[model samples]
Target: MVVSLKEAKLYLRIDSDEEDTLITSFILTAEEICEEILRFPLSEFEEVPKLVKQALLYCIANMYEKREGSYYYMKNEGGGMAETIGIMKIILGNLRKESW
Candidate 1:
């Protein structure tokens, strides 16, 4: 749980407790996606890097905002979300552990 429920709520602009469970789930999903992208378990790190944390925030926020969509439409619609994901991917790539 790199992103706490409080942080997720704050990012989501959710001020009530009614959707806490849902928000928590989104946070977990985001963390899993981030870990997958990084090719390493986030728990292994003593402290999550700031860039990683930002990436997680973006991922969670994107998921929360677009839960209704079956897939992320990454074409021509301002491209903000797609660009965010692209930035996250680059951050994850730089942070990923290399195995020999």
Candidate 2:
């Protein structure tokens, strides 16, 4: 995993382990979304950029805080950050490798 559970928890300021599983899922989801946005799997990169990691934390935080509502990743139904699509278009897009 590019971002560890501990790291994600720290970013979310999560003090309890009760939601570890959920957080883990979020990490995985965020990783995949980020990869898609960058058009590259994280494993292919020799070194993951700090911005991409930070964006992962942003994604996790968004999901954890807004778990009550219906989450729309790409659509601006709720309205928030422009990169809400995955918190990747801006952050991860800059790092996009276009490996095709």
Please, what is the whole-model Cα lDDT of each candidate in the order they appear?
0.78, 0.78
Error of 2 at 70 (Å): 5.1
Clashing pairs in 2: none
Q: Put down candidate 2 lDDT per residue, 6-60, tens digits, no spaces.
A: 9999888889999999999988988887877787688987888788888888887
Per-residue CA lDDT of model 1 for 3-33, tens digit only, reads 8999888877889999888888988887887
Q: Tell me the number of clashing residue pairs for each predicted model.
A: 0, 0
Worst 10 residues of 1 by lDDT: 70-79
User: In model 1, which residue pairs have backbone atoms overlapping below 3 Å?
Assistant: none
Error of 2 at 64 (Å): 1.0
Q: Estimate each model's TM-score.
A: 0.80, 0.81
Name the regions of candidate 1 deviating beyond 4 angstroms.
70-85
